[model samples]
Target: MVDKADKTAKVAPAKVKGGKKTSPAEFIRQVQTEGRKVVWPTWPETVRISIFVFIMMIILSLFFLGVDSAFGAVVSWLLTLA
Candidate 1:
């Protein structure tokens, strides 16, 4: 009655010791290699993303304001009942 999926899930991956540890000097070299792969956004792309982010921020601010006002109204009404 055991499912194949359940059986496979019980088996764990083998653990290795000390095979993947990198020296501090080697780590810095790896970091520099990765740093070279980064390409910065063009000025136009940066401007577009900045505008998009600004619009989203304004939208989220309005949404939170409305939500807070609704909660405040509910709380004020409940307080009046007491």
Candidate 2:
């Protein structure tokens, strides 16, 4: 029977073989090809996302303010009992 250590041994990822370096023109061409694949958002979509983020920020801040106030009041009342 195999030992537990042998059964659970880690295997390393294969290393990439070194290949020929790409020329500068080829690199630029590849970059342009990749750039064409990107899909950028329009102005209205960006504005909507920004507005949503701001609303969430305000709502969360009000929630935390309420929680902090409640905890402070409870601690103050407990101190008075001592």
* TM-score of model 2 (CA atoms): 0.63
lDDT of candidates 1 onward, in order: 0.92, 0.93
How displaced is residue 44 in candidate 1, in Å?
A: 1.1
**Alpha carbon lDDT of residue 33, candidate 1?**
99
List the candidate 2 regions with Cα displacement exceeding 4 Å: 1-8, 18-36
Residue 59: error of model 2 in Å? 0.3
lDDT by residue for model 2 (1-82), tens: 8899998999986543355577789889989999999999999999999999999999999999999999999999999999
User: What overall lDDT, based on C-alpha atoms, would model 1 receive against the true structure?
Assistant: 0.92
Best by lDDT: 2
Q: Write down the RMSD of all candidates, one decimal each.
A: 3.8, 4.3
